[model samples]
Target: MRGQRRVWVAAGVLGAAIVAAGLWGIGGRQDAPRAAAQPAGIPVTLARVAHEDLTQNIDGVGTVTSLHSVLVRPQVEGLLTALLVEEGQMVEKGQLLATIDDRAIAAALEQAEATRQSNQAQLRIVEQDLQRYRTLSQRGSISRQILEQTEAEAARLRGTLRGNQATIEAERVRLSYTRITSPVAGRVGIRNVDVGNLLRTNDSSGLFTVTQMSPISVVFALPQETLPRLQPLLGGAAPVVAHSRDGGELLGEGHLNSIDNQVASSTGTIRARAVFDNPDGKLWPGQFVTVDLRAGVLRNGLVLDSRAVRRGLDGAYVFRIEEGKAQKVPVRIVQEVEGRSLIEGLAAGDEVVLDGHSRLTPGARVEIQGDAQALARRSQP
Candidate 1:
């Protein structure tokens, strides 16, 4: 009986040990899955934040325009006898551009002058006769009524002389109008009328178009938000530059000429104009261009790569690495310049995570792969 009891106890002990081993194995399998689910460390790319001058600028599209443009037209109606200026030729102000057939106008002027000279001679003779009549009446050699008649005749002759003189002056003015001259100093465009073409005073189409190309105007629009900052700088005499469509080449440099008084309600923008010396004729009227309004230098500002900035539920923030862990720092962006951001709430030297920000959380560990020198080189100056 004693041997059987000992056998049963031994069997019980072995069965208990087997059950415990199976439970341990099950727990180990569950824990293995959990361990695999958790990440070992957060993988991220980092960039060092440094200070640099951040230029706050606004960009917009604009068109080149001539400072002055005019359509050349004849002031009088006549046959076009001569065209002195060629198409696309430069002309000065008051330079004779064309001449109309002035033979009829000249003949009228000559006839008027001859009549005026005859009137002047008759007026002289009448004046002398009136003086002699007055003296004869005062000496009682002639009747008072006869002297009065002579005086009235003299006055009529004087009036006729004045009328003839006015006619002559009018004819002279009409003759001078036959010669067409440039109203301004500019380059002439294609001519619409050729020699022997009959031009009329009532015609609306001009003979040619002239434009001042040396000093050109550029008109551009700016967003309402950017206008306040730019308004103060515009008062200063500073140079602005325009770039090509690709932004690789500089089209020209100019100064802000004027700003519109009212903002555009529909677009929430303001129009501004600038003047450029286009001696090379690089800018032409109605040609679209890119405008850059350069605000003055910014001293001691913190700049970061534009990619480093991220939008969160709260606001704009950046991933700053502190003690090998990323901390989301809220920042206020002042401006964006050349693919970089000018921000507040950041110091001179801070390590910011530029890439892999989506996977990173506050207090998450980070691994910086490259040196600061490489990042510095990559940053825009």
Candidate 2:
């Protein structure tokens, strides 16, 4: 019994020893990982904000419009014998565009001409008789009443000749109408009628349309609140520019033509037009484009790269670098020009992050790569 009790006590002691050894091994383990080292600062590009002369311009969407557009219609009713202009052909003012069958008009003109000639011949005979009668009266060989009667006959023949001449002029005008011409210098549009088609003055669809391409106009609108600034500039010949929607390509440059007399009630904007010399035909009619109207200049305006400005729940804000750390700074965007933004809150000489701002937070350590001010200093002589 004593030997068995000793054996059981030894077994309990052995088990406790093993369990304590395992616990010690885990507690004093030397292979465990250490706490992670602090992450390095976020790398970013920076630009030094500064005050510069910025143009206060208004940007808006605009539509291209032609200065003059006309529908070419025949003035006289006749069969279209010739089409002198083709679709999309540039034409000059008074250039012949079409020809009508003028045979009937020519016949009428010839008849009038013959009548005028016959009346002229009768007038000459009457004048000769009047002269002979006057000579006879002066010689006391014929009565004075007979001389006066011959004078009256000559005057009547002269009146008849004048009437025939007027008729001939009318026929000439009608004949001219058979040869249709462009009333303005422009590019011809689609042809509505072909040769052998009868054209009439009252035709709903005209022969064609002509649109003045060069020196074309663009119509746009701006907010009514901008009137105070735009109105003053309108009196002067302020310059306006048009660009592609992305603002990468310049469409054309022009000056303000006119502003609407009143603001639109529904839109709360005023319509305006600018005329551009479209010699290259870049600005086409009915094209929607971006319009930039230079109202005035804002001297000493704070500027920053447009990408630096970001929107959060609060509003527009920028990540500004201060003391090697990025700090959130609220900014009021006054204007955007040439891929840069004019901000209100930032001061001159302050640095702002341009790129890699997504991983930034307030008071975050930042390592700037492309510092614009630093590069400018390095470039200096």
Candidate 3:
């Protein structure tokens, strides 16, 4: 019975080994075909070369400034009686902004005027006497000495009248200073001196600041390297746009006005000013902003998406797609602005790869990803 059982076990082991070997051979055959198959083309996005006028803009940070900024300070010493305009009020040139105590100046003016009237009446009486004395001397009724003394009296009175007239004028000018007016057409700043406070001509703090807003100015700085390009745009109608510091919100539009005479040696930058007609009053002084100044335009430029231009060991180049294959083309970058690059060495309507450039090489096959909207914005001006 033991011999029969041992023979049966050996037969079962041999059958199991044969079935396992057959399964292993089938798995090897399936893997062999997959390893031999060629790789698929690299996925990429493409844009056609565009022939259009490409505008080049240089971007920099700037500050909103006022064209005319003046301190509204008192010209004479007096007690502040009233403030006609409130803080942050918009005022015109010569508009009354505040009033100082004018009683002292008015009293002095009245006193001078009264003295002038008295002197004038006395001078008239003396002149009549002098004229009669001259006529009497001619008729031999008055002595020559009397006529000369009368002439001297008339001259003295005339001098006193002239002095009085000058005092009255000086008093009038001092009285005018009591009424403070806006020196410029602009918005007022915070009041430094309150009503009923004493105001002095030499006060360190002024009453307020009046800054012109309608025609405001923006002062910005550009890199020294851009000086050559910036010189030609000065005094021209170079459009300047003021945007929020994040470069998203449109604040206002202006033009290049002036450039600083010398570049800042410490910062290697040049300061420039732009004038904007701020009709909407959106711009405020001391506000930081992003400025876009027109540098120049490329005529009939070979416009390519900025992403398509890649920097390699041999300088800038682009991978152009020709007949579904990436052909490496050397290019020169003229200008780049707003994600569009003005490039050379590519013809209009030629397609270039804008994305998935990592897997690209000369003559490598590519698979294009389609997007009408992206393609339109990428290439077309």
lDDT of each: 0.84, 0.86, 0.89
Off by over 4 Å in 2: 1-49, 128-159, 232-237, 246-248, 307-332, 345-381
TM-score list, all predictions: 0.82, 0.70, 0.77
Residue-wise C-alpha lDDT for candidate 2, range 128-166, written one tens digit per residue: 988888888989999999988888988888888889889
Candidate 2: 10-residue stretch with minimal lDDT: 30-39
Task: Give, for candidate 1, the lowest lDDT window spanning 10 residues.
Answer: 372-381
Residues 298-344 of candidate 1: C-alpha lDDT, one tens digit per residue: 87788888888998788899989898888989999888877888899
RMSD of 2: 7.6
lDDT digits (tens) for residues 179-211 of candidate 3: 988888999999897888989889978999999
> After superposition, which runs of candidate 1 have C-alpha atoms over 4 Å from their true positions?
1-38, 140-163, 311-316, 361-364, 372-380
For TM-score, candidate 1 versus 3, the one ahead is: 1
Spell out the clash pairs found in candidate 1.
none
lDDT of 1 at 174: 84
lDDT of 2 at 290: 93
RMSD of each: 4.3, 7.6, 7.1
Please tell me which predicted candidate would have the highest TM-score against the true structure: 1
